[model samples]
Target: MDIDLNTLRASIDAEVNRREFERLPARDDDSLPAAGLIDSVAAFEPIDLEGYLPEPPEEHQHIEPELVAELLPEGRFYNWLKRPPFARHLQRPRIYSLLTRASRLPGGARLSNFIYIMARGIAYRIPALARLLEQSKQWRYLPGRLAGFEYQANQGLYAHALAVQRNERYLLDRLQRLEQRLREQQAQAARTAGAPAAEAASPPAAMPADLYVDFEAHFRGSREEIRQRLAANIPRFKAVAALFSEPVLDLGCGRGEWLQLLQESGIAAVGVDSNPSMVQCCLDAGLQASVGDGLAYLQGLPDHSLAGLTAFHVIEHVPLDVLVRLIDEARRVVRPGGIVLFETPNPENLIVGACNFYTDPTHRNPLPPALVAFLLEARGFIRVEIERRHPADPKLLLQGQDDGLVQPLNRLLFGPQDYAAIGHAP
Candidate 1:
């Protein structure tokens, strides 16, 4: 199919313009500058949205009334689990319930625990109450669910006590073993100063690159699904096609989805990944890929040797130090005018930042658009623009939001779930 890059770009821009802070002052607007990087600000820092107010209520529209307290956002609750006391608890419902009951024992099962268990079982297992609970979102907030504030608060204390007990046992075991090993090693080192005592100074072992591959299908999606997803961003790829006269290098090419898109479009590209399984899968698909650390591969390349580079959904897995290094390496290896793109989950979207981002335990942090733009500029990447992708359906966004709060609420709740930071090497 012939690509209309302009039209696709316009479609993407239109969605962004609609959902972003356009009505607010330019300083608070969502669109970022492309010619230079935005200023370095922490991704999690509070933005200056001080004066931006929700629009006036619409006179003609009315939303179905569910009591205010019944609306429990799933993503918000997942982030709450990241807190100190709550974080320590066993996330499993059955385990938490068992532990809670055991903790209350004087000599036998406590009445509160018995009641809670029996009630939960009867409510969920019986046809009548089970159906009622199935119908009501509020029931999910019951004990062990969201509404168990007091129960969960007590669970926090129980979790802390258990954690302390386990940690003490582990520490005692490790310390005794460590002391013995250290004394033996110290004696050996003293006896062999000239015999090379460098074992203790060796760098830590490499993390198993395939550590999270088992969860890839859940988080990264199937190859066909990923390709269909990329199909929505044809303009983004078209921009890539226009900029590169040579093969593009795809970093962390999980499942070779983008590589497949590029090759099918007759665009030349090579994929690199640390996961051996991913690399082999790419090869089996008849796409070019290599197994190695992405940063190390970039560092090994000759200066200004490539025409373009892309790292989709890769940066979030890297430490900030290595992320900067990757940017620097890209600047060094890709020739002038070569395009550099990094697509990540858009944390500005509350649901994505708070919920989906955590599904991939490999993700280090969500890079806000401003911080990424700033980093690219810091490494001399120019024309750093961001494009929001995969917005929620307009119909869904409009429902119950006939009030002027639609746009503001959409920006807060239903904005694009992903973004691509595009720039060119200077």
Candidate 2:
């Protein structure tokens, strides 16, 4: 459908004219550029009010709330309300502003960025919500529609606003954990430095010569699920894996899935798994597979030997103390400017703790994105990005594989609920 530019223009003119009539500004009003009016109109034009479909029915809306937030007057919702159409730009920022200001100061840039990111999801969903608005057969009150939109928008806007404002507490708590972990790693490194060369030469934990048996036990019959997950991870893994331009290590590479994807993408890859049967299976597939402890395995390698390393869903299994050791060892082996891509199940996901969290008996706890980002930043990583993924339903998690794809079905019946954090070494 196409946007009814005329309707938009008429609405703007009516609103602007009404505002001017109520409180006519002097010559200053005439001097103001007409660009603001046009821009605002354009912002609202993209979203097809299906019930009020302009003409075009794009899958997504044109007015991005983030852009709207940036355009809104002085970033203050209160001021916009006193104005005309600007007051209804999006209800989220206003609610967030009120809640955040009242509780405490928000986390400067990070907090704002975080809220905007979540708000973007709400904006994307607006088209669907707008569709519902249009189809509300009995709902004929324009004022009621406007109010409903405003209330729904506000709900989306402030869904996580309070958390971002309160993120500072988590930040401080994470920093302390990092500092303490570093001290322990430093002490361990010192002791290892003094060990006899031969003692240090002992081989890292060995993988079983045959891994197929173990692969069968852990992965079992989920071949298609493995393929889908690997495909999803390939591009991300490649983003960092390609940097090394050399054979890289995939620590805790589950079932050698990622390694296979990397190899197909033409990056040389070796996988190390702690599960003996998994190592054997991968090796039988003609891949270089080893069963080993991740940290000890990294330490035994020559310093700066690796171009990159990947540890997906690996660190969560290690205790907090061992986590630093793993990162430290990764730093030592990877060349300067090398990349490390770490991903784990997001704790914020509804089923993560309740269902998927128990899939692996070894999983200690859900890894919150904020906590992961904090740990990496303290460890001297430069760029950090946190992402959330949709968790597979219990059918997929428990049955190893489901003939019916449960993730999409659950998202249809439910919604998304997974998270991840990515960071780079300085």
Candidate 3:
């Protein structure tokens, strides 16, 4: 690169200005010096305007690397002083710390202050340590500067949120009014056009068989696998099954696993589901099955008629208020001393609730085990028990450790993924 005479002069002036800044007297409160004042001229190393200066070759291009290293110069006096024996060490961290302490003391105070500033500037290069250093500087004003938002901004945000809510309500009200008006117009046209015309135009109320079956296939396991799992748990069902004179009623019986298990155990049972294909599959397998909404079926049954009522992984598909009503109906429809069992995905298992439970789009929300138990008791059902089911892998669970930490960790990581709320109707 070429060096211009004007640029060379400017660079020389900047070096002199930098030296003047270093000689400036220190302030009382430890503020920075006026070093930034020379920044304009500091941009030039040498005045290379005409490309007169040569650029160095790339690092690894030379065969004799040591010769290339020798080209860089170090002052003779400094090199002799920095050598071994007479030169043990020129600097250490402790020396800087002692210098900082001396800055607060009586004599040599100004020199110590300059050393302290230089040491801290070097320390700020490491990001992790630098953040802690920065926090120390901001300690007094942290509360006022939290998230850097002002009081005015918070108030404005609150007002904007309220306005958005009001606009949403207004739009909903207008939509409902428009729907009602459209319905009225349709009804008026039906009166003039005839009942047959209205019937022809009406849409189907039930979900298509192929679509419903496909949805079940996407979210559910095979019927054979479910039956095998249910068969393994037949001992638990038998205890409840033996207490009743009439057959059990299994509502929302997806693939008839419980129904098949009840038959194999010689316990009479009937199943009901909203899906026609599911009900047909159950009937084809010679199980007594019916197509109907679970809630409506429970309502239609005579009071205290069924021996036991069991619905697995079904309650979470309905609204909370509807679930509460279903519990009340279960207590009513079940005979005295009969079992009412409702199982659902447990919200207590962090993984089940936060992740796996949502794999099925039909699931509304996970039901807390305690909440279901409390609901059963509130609805005049006694001897209620919360039975956690389907625990995750044992290796994942923190176990066999005497420490208190492992127990909570075990409950969070390997606790039951699903739970059953069992109660006896009085």
Candidate 4:
């Protein structure tokens, strides 16, 4: 391998100039004193420049006159002692670079500054430490410098160790709790698994075939709550009334709130609810209502007989296939020019969608505005317009606070879930 002596000389000169030392002498060490160049020259020895400086093996080949002068020189003395070539000459510049880079030293300190600087420099510049030490060739000065660096670096190292220990303790505690829970769940699951098989072997409980068969049982308790809300909506039901001049069907109409409004507005309105309790309550209130399934009642209506239809918060609980069928039913009943004014809870309200939404065991899902609009439009309903009512309750502010950024971002990007769709059959 051939080493580029000219390039090696150029790099050595560059290193020396970086330390503000004089240019390389053309002659050898026989003439001048090599004072400041030792630190710079020694620093370059550890770097494997074989790829750059490939040369053949010979006694004269590896030896640079400048490097030789810097290393194995004859008699050179600085102050009170004689200086050997490779012994130790940590000139002021290397000392300054070490201390200033670590931001530890001030100007005009004693020569002992090199001791602290070397310790920290080694820690600060790890793999570079060996290279720098080889370049400085000042390893012969004090072996204690290595130990000092280990001590300095250990300060932060111990703090990290304590934090890791605390994290391990926390994880172990959580793991133990999880293991206990798994054991309990396994035992409980074994017991319940047996019970299900026993029940399956026994005579099965009779189930209601149609939803209307047991609808009254669920509504008996919530009858007053439904009736009160329905009664309150009596006057504000003008939206559906204004949509049609012909007959209208009100779906899931508990106690006929909109029917009363339609009657007062002088528009024909009919109420069909599956809950017998709710139907009786509507009759007691002197409003026209009947105990029957909404889908069946809507389907039974003569084609093109109705002018409008309105279903509020009722679509979400309806299955998707059932919903499409209901849309077909709505299309069948309403005349070509009539409108369907439908409302459902918006899924965009995070508290409602994520938490309160599931409280009603019967609710299938919250119907989003886009989904409702798309289904209605696809089923031959034209001129569909969506509107959002009922801002989320102030109680949901706590949940909404964390999801504030998320809610608006989704609304901007995907549109809202809880809204109303008013579409015509045109």
lDDT per residue as tens, model 1, 1-426? 344667666765665555443333365656755444433232223434333444444322332223111321223433353355654443444534443454354533344544566687768878988888777756555645745677787899999999999999899767754653464354346445643221111011243435555567766667677788777545655666687676789998877888888888777889888777778888999999987778667756776777788887888887786687677777778887778888899999998899988887667789999999998875667789998987765676745636786777888678898898988876
Better of 1 and 4 by lDDT: 1
In model 2, where do residues sit more than 4 Å from their true spots? 1-221, 237-243, 391-418
Model 3 lDDT per residue over 1-426, tens place = 445778667866777676756655667876666653435444434443345455654432332423322332233433453356423332333433343354454543455454566677678988887998988879967867864667778888999999999999899767754654464354446445653311100012245755766766665567776676567557766876777668899888766778988998999899988777777878988899997777667766777888898888888887776686577667767888788888888889998899988877667778888889998876667789998887877878665657688888788877888888889865
Candidate 4: lDDT over CA atoms? 0.60
What's the CA error at residue 295 for candidate 2, in Å? 0.6
What would the per-residue lDDT of candidate 4 be over residues 288-345, giving only the tens digit for each residue? 8886667656645676788788886678766786687677768767887877877776
Candidate 3, residue 385: how far the Cα is off, in Å? 0.5
lDDT of 4 at 179: 50
Worst 10 residues of 3 by lDDT: 196-205
Residue 61's C-alpha lDDT in candidate 2? 38
Overall local distance difference test of candidate 2: 0.61
TM-score of 4: 0.42
Tens-place lDDT digits, model 2, residues 1-426? 566778877876776566544443345555664433334433333333364555543223354544545533343433444355653544454444443343233533244544564565575579985576566644677678899899999988797787776797789767855864575467457657873221111112333324433533564337556566657756755665556665678887656777777778877788887766666667777778786776667767876787678777776776676676666666667676767777677656556657766665556677777877887777656577776665444454432267478654555333445455666555
Which residue runs of candidate 1 sit more than 4 Å off their true CA positions?
1-211, 232-245, 393-398
